[model samples]
Target chain A: MDLTLDRIRLAYPDGDGVLVAVDDVTLTVPSGTTTALLGPSGAGKSSLLAVAGAPLDAPDDAAGAPRAARGPRRRARRAADRAAALRRERIGIVFQQPQLVASLTVLEQLELMSHLRGRPAASRRAHALALLDAVGVADRADRRPEHLSGGQRQRVAIARALMNDPQVLLVDEPTSALDHERGVQVVELVVRLARELDAAALLVTHDEATLDPVAARVHLADGRLVEAPAAV
Target chain B: MFLALRDLRHARGRFALMITVVALITFLVAFLAALTAGLGRASTSAVTELPVDRLAFAPPAEGASPTFTESEVTPHQQEAWADVPGVGAAEPLGVATVRASGESTAAVTAFGVRPGSGLVPGTGDGGADVSAGTVVLSRGAADALGADVGDQVGAGPLDLTVAAVADAEADFAHTPVVWVSLDDWQAVGARGDAAAGDAQDGPTATVVALRFGDDPPTADALAATDAELGTVTATPREARSAISSFTAENLSLTLMQVFLLAISALVVGAFFTVWTIQRAGDVAVLRALGASTRYLLRDAIGQAGVVLGVGVGLGTALAAGAGLLAARVMPVVVDVSTTLVPAVVLVALGGLGAVLAVTRVARVDPHAALAAR
Candidate 1:
């Protein structure tokens, strides 16, 4: 499925006013394509990724101001519920750290996504095993996160993200903890899996060296998209 | 309970330690509860098991409390209570702690009542009555004195033969009871000086036992009669407090049991509070994965219930076994109320404590998981 963020904007409260995080950001990533969002630290790359993944509330119609409706209260409860449902149904998020639940094994971690979506674990076993095989860690399916290496853990996390067949896959600095070679290989694997699974992939990273594997790249500065780079 | 079950399996050492703590607390709670019930029974079974509905004692002095030890009822008070409307039968009952001997000597509560009265079990039949020098011993009293029917036993100042043993077992103030006639009791208690003054005024019966029909005496009428006659009337169960030693001993043991229960709850709360804090990161991750607050709460409480159930079950079993063993050597009585009630209470209170602790999961911020914090 294709994901389109039409004029999406986000902001946070500053000392005396509000600071824009994603300024009128309009972007689209069609199925089977990998888009890397790159910028310096504090460039609003994470904010844009967060907005796309439905983790943060959408920006207000007002310019350079945070939407005042996102605070926790009875009035904003319906909006929060809708946002939560969106995340549950159509979004898959991978954090900078593996973020693997330590108690679950590799296979169970993947199965948990299906379980969250209301599928029985027994019925999802074959699919979970298949995803584990696709991620090239099927042999370690029964091992917990503590038993796996950093690269292997990230692979299991990737498999878990795809377990629900989410429409949009959001990657947040997934290679931040890896070496140069390992980071490059992880990025390549994400690109390959995104294409194979026909997912609209958004890769957010500060490491510019890993952008070579992405099909397209976007740059953001000071909460606004500076320019849209050509497709690779 | 997907994550909950996995956590239990993965953190076996930590959960095992928690379960052990719960087990020990449950063991103490169940044992104390059983002991409390057993001791209460040993102290009050004689009065509680009586056929009469109420007992009347002599009224205390101004600003004083009425006690079985200090209260003595006169024949006039007994007659007044007997003549009260709706009072079917009223019998004089005397209770005194005295030394009784057969082959060996032991302290026993001598209960003085009329032979034909319903108060003494197996007395209306061909069973020998307590005449001048005869007494009926309860099975427990017989066991304590190592004496049987046709054996001789000695009370305060008189030697009496054990005519027949009563079938029902009753105890008062942790002492076996020996049933004797009211005349014999008065003879034994009368002082040489008091007996010489007025034959009816020497130490009278300790209390008056009353039986009520379907239409029984009202509490107001009973109080009025007691006020007019200078006496106190109480239902059989309410009269337990009149036994000063039983009341004090029971309160202390019961207070300890209550304290133990409170400590169990606090221990459970503290343990789960730390467990929830340790897993705050995992909770945030689950929240970010679209797990609702309700779902997480159910999972946490269900996990706690599993632990409590297992721990309480094992502890109750151990308590029952220990109670059975203790019954042989002590005044312990192992029954369903003493064992099962405590197990159920421990699990319920432990679960409540756990729920209080795991509610912190609702406050965890999903954004923290994104920060790798």
Candidate 2:
């Protein structure tokens, strides 16, 4: 399924005032395509991604402003439950850091996703191994994150996110810790995997150098989405 | 258990340390349980092993409790007990501690009864005649005296022959008992009391052992008889506390065992509480990755179960071995109450502590996993 973030809003309060993190933000990533959310830090890139990936109750409390209603209170609860279920089965997320479980081996990390989805581990072994191979870390399948290099860990994390063949892939600054050359290569790998798997990919990043493989770039200045590049 | 098992293997040193603590606590609890049981046996077996349902004693002064050491039931009190409605059998139980000399000499609690009162250790097995001069010795008494039937032993200047050794084991105040005739007991105790210038005039004994029939008299009837005769009666179990020093000693050991059990649970709670706090971040990541609260709790409890089972199992085995060794030189009874009960309790309470600790997994904010560290 395609991911649609219709005119959603997120705001925080600042000294007797509301600071909008996202304002009427509307965007979409169709199947088999990629959408790159890029901006400077504090531009609400992460907050907007949170709204799309894990829908929560809009903040309307001290130090925060009201968010656009996803629906009624009961409906919103159902929606959040629906969203959680979707995340388990259809959405894949990659945080800025590798964040691979310290105890899980490379292959086990991906298999864990299938296990969470209630799939038999034995049945997913070959698939987990194949995903690791696709990310160029097949030989390191038996090794834990402690022994792997930073780039290798990121590769494993990427493979783990894709283990369930998600419809929407959310990438958050996956190359922030890698060297310039390696960063470019990691983004390229993500782009290639998204296209090969036909997943609607949303890549959040601040590095301009890594935008070569990102098909569409949506910029956020202060919680509001700027128009797509004129190249569109 | 996927995460639980791996976490244990990855952090073997930490888990092993916790397991050792659990093992030692289990060992302490099990060992103390055995000791309490053994002491209880030594203190009250002589009374508990009696065939009667209850023992009747002359009431103490206005507020004092009934005690075997101070109780003295006369022939009149025995006749009153036997005459009570629903009284199946009432036999006088005369008890006295005196030094006896045989192949091996030791202090023995001499039990005095009628020749055919059927209170002797091996009554049906032709134990001892309990006539004027012969006495039946319990296994422990015989063991201490090193005497067989026809062997002679003397008690307080009174000579008697050991008629037979019975398989029963009886003790009072940690001393084995020797069954003798009421006449013989009166002769011996009478001499001692006379020599001490406090001899009683008539036949007197310690207490009257009673057994109730199928249609036993109600409590009201028993109370009326007691009021009329000015006596008190207690079930075998209640009478056990009347044994000198039995209550205080048993209470202390039991209290210690209870404290050990409570301490083990608290220690387990403290350890897991810290463990859970230490891994809160990992828990957040797991929850963020779609692992449900049930899954996390199961994993944690499974980890605790492994720790408790292995630890308690090891500890019980050690305690059993220790009990076997201790039994030879000291009073220690190793049985299910000492081993299995403690092991089960350790696991249950340890699991409870773990549940209290890991429930925090339910409140972990999956959103935190997205925060920049």
Candidate 3:
């Protein structure tokens, strides 16, 4: 499935007026491709990615559009419920810090996707183990996130994001805490996983050097998309 | 419960502490309940376990509750109650606490009943042959005076022989009871002036014990009869309040139990509130990952249930054991109402507190998970 952000507009409350984080932006990431959202700090790349993952009451047919469109109270609630279900079943989110539950092991982190969808985690053990093997972290499956290295944790997060075979994978600064070499390797793994899973992956990162493995790139500045140089 | 179970196991120390707190509170409540019931039995068993269904007392001043300490019923009042519809037998019963000397000196409540009145505990079999100078001693009264059947005991102004020591135990106002003839009681009470042809009208007793037929009078009918007879009537159980110490003692203990329950609920709520706040970030992440509000609430409340279950179970067991041991030295009735009821109430109130605390789960913004924290 393709991830389309059609004329998306995201705003937040400022001192007196609204600060538009994503200004009528339209973007698409076709299936089986990695589209890197490159931008500096406060460029609204993370905001746009968040909107794509689960848009907040958006009128346009953005990714995860509002389901209810009539009554304000019920509509907002229904929309949030719909968006959460969308994120659970179809969209896998990978945050900057791995966002792993401290009590869960690396293997259970991936299996959580199945559990969140109300399925038994044991039923998906083989698949979870296979994903860990694919991510080259099978040896560390039973270890908590604190015991794993930064790159390994990021790999685990990526594997977890793919646990449900999501059509859209949204990742935000997954390599911020890693060194230069480890950061490139993590991004490369994300790109490879996207291709293998046929997921429309939108990765948010300010480090343009890690775009070697990503197929397409789009830059955002001042909450508006700009043309980017071709990937290596 | 996937996350909830793991959370509990991961933080066993914290959860254990919480369980201990719940258990201690449950223990206090359960033990207090048992003690309260036991003390209540000691204070009012004689009046409550009476063979008669009701008792009639000289009506108190308007707006005042009846009291055995002040009630004085005459033979005329007993005759009036016997005439009321649905009445079976109305017997005059006099109650007086006095010091008696047998092998030892002890305080005993002297119960005065007419010969063949069938009011004594063992009198169900055509009544004990209690004569004017003889008394039937309850087992408690026997124990206190260290006296046996055929032993002579001095009570009030009369010296009486123990005709028989009744097998049943009865107490009135925390003192053992001794049954005696009504004539002997009146003589010991210095009401013999009437028998001596003095100006006093007649003899009097504390209250009239009224036994009813199978088809008893309704409340309204009883009230009407009471008004006509110039007396107040109450069922034996209801008459317990007339024992001055019972009402105050029961109220104080019950209030303690109620306050402890409230404290346990507040403590559980406060613990859960702080816990939910600490895990607000994790909750946001889960919401973002598609866990519904209802699901999270269920998980958190289930966690509280586990803690309360283990705690209350352990506490009740502890209380039962302690209560049994305490029963050896003091009155402590360990039973279902004292143990299980308090435990269930604790879990319910504690769960309420936890539910209120974890409601913050619904308000946690999923967008917060996007930030570094």
Candidate 4:
């Protein structure tokens, strides 16, 4: 397994005490595979994916299963800076919305990933172009987000997530705004990209119809994972 | 500044409006600064540009600053100052405004200096001949009276010949100057005491010009001399306040410039504050994408710096052109102090406002981008 979660727990401040968002959920997704977390609203599917992406710091001594200790490099990078470097170097996140920067073009969106890691974006132009080509949005590469359709923007976002060739891809509802057919197409596209890039993908979605292309499925409810009888 | 440049290009209209506001403020500040300096020169050039390092004025009332208007230094006071150690040359300078009738009549300040005092610009170099009954006219005074060298001018009960026109120009109380002998100034009945031509103990001139030869008197020694002579002394710069018009005019103009500077800073701050708040969602997305807080702040401030540089550069150029044109009809100086100094100050203050506004980037949570919009 390229990505592992050992009883990951996450909580947020409620009115007085704490409201646990994810509790004692241990899961692993091997490389070149996609795992779909299927649950309804408030099921903590997004929270688990967020933890795997390392956006929210995993609580120490969480559920008597403390997170893996940081190595020398991670220890030296300092809290937020460390997380940011982790995301920039190893984890790729796809938000619920396309969330394309209004000022950037489709091609520049991929180029920005390289820029964030303190590399000259121009140095990776060929790779960025190849990613866009792989995602089948090469024709719309020069267009701005407003000029692209909803499905096209999602594809461009997928291409951007793979720009740095991250090891773990965490996608949250890639087709939330799409219709049935487009939703299936986007999920299939994510599976293909994850396999081709040989990256472990954890996708959070409540749409059961889109799970056919996903390699495995897990059920979550009220911040805890349920044992699915037919673990497909 | 990659994102910054793109954003600026994408939102040209908003940034253009901000740049215009900054430019207009810079124009107003630079122009006012030039006018203030010019007006100051017109009001006190004659006194400030004197050849001596210091001027001794009759002491004012208790707890009051010295004034050239009310000061009256007598011959006895002048003699006392001349006898002081390190006193190189103490010359009596009488300042009085009178009407001069030459080819035309104009109000002129008669500066009374003894022969070979070199208090006038053209005296030592033979550019002007300052004998009895002959006056040396500053270029401004010559132009005002339409009198050239060897021309005769009637200066308040004294018929004086313009022996030579001085190379430089000086003004006092906004009137052109004409150098006259000490006797001629006394003959005009503009002395402190009104004796109507009878021999009387009266003020020789308004102030005495004091020049240090090799070793100037120490501050303590000068203070002691002031106490002994019942007088007060000031450097040429400090004496500028003694001119009644200069003090009021300069203070008002300087205050206006200061206010404009403050307004520019607030305007820049307000503009960037609104811009930052409006784009907070974008900032969150960027953070989630792994952009450091330091990177975003640099991009924002670099954008502001580019705008300020262009706007202030254009505004300063406009002021210089306008000042050149305005100088033809009025007093307006266009120089480095008036233009470049104000521009640098505007950029600094405006940059500070931008820094304050963009610091909010650090507080944006990257997790917010994970939620559904």
After superposition, candidate 3 runs with Cα above 4 Å error = A55-75, A229-232, B125-129, B188-203
Which parts of model 1 have CA positions greater than 4 angstroms off?
Answer: A6-9, A13-21, A57-82, A228-232, B124-128, B189-197, B201-203
Q: Tens digits of per-residue lDDT for model 1 on A1-232?
A: 8879889877677889988877998889998888888887888888777677665432222222355633533234344445656766778888878899999989899887776666776578888898888879999999999999998998888888888777888899989888888899889988988898898999999788877888688888877888754549
* lDDT of candidate 3 over A110-211, digit per residue (tens): 888898888998889999999999989999999998899878888998898899999999999988999889899989888888999999999999987777
Model 1: per-residue Cα lDDT over B1-373, one tens digit each:
8888889998989888888888888788778877887888788888888888889888787886678888777777888888999999989988888889998899888888876877887665666667668888988899999999888998877889988889877889989888888777775553343234465555468889999977997889888888898888888888888887788898898888788888888888899999999999998777777766667888898888878888888888888899899987777777888788888888878888999999877666666777621
- Please list the residue runs of candidate 2 whose C-alpha ends up more than 4 Å from where it truly belongs after superposition: A12-20, A55-83, A227-232, B187-203
Which candidate number has the best DockQ? 3
Q: Write the per-residue lDDT of candidate 3 for residues B1-373, one digit (tens) a residue.
A: 8888999998899999999999999999999999998998888888988889899988888899999877887778888898888889999988778899899999988888888888888777754567889989988899889999889999987999999888886888888899889878775552334335453456468899999887888889999988888899988999999988999999999999999999999999999999999999889888888777677888898888898899999999999999999997877889999999999999999999999998878667777887621
For each candidate, what is the lDDT? 0.81, 0.82, 0.86, 0.86
lDDT of 3 at A64: 39
By lDDT, the better pick of 1 and 4 is 4
When candidate 3 is compared with the true two-chain complex, its DockQ is 0.44
Task: Give RMSD to native, each candidate.
Answer: 4.2, 4.3, 4.0, 4.7
Clash number for each model: 0, 3, 0, 0
Window of ten residues with lowest summed lDDT in model 2 chain A = A57-66
Q: What is every candidate's C-alpha DockQ against the true complex, given to 2 decimals?
A: 0.37, 0.32, 0.44, 0.39
**Top-down TM-score ranking:** 4, 3, 1, 2
Q: B261, model 1: CA deviation in Å?
A: 1.1
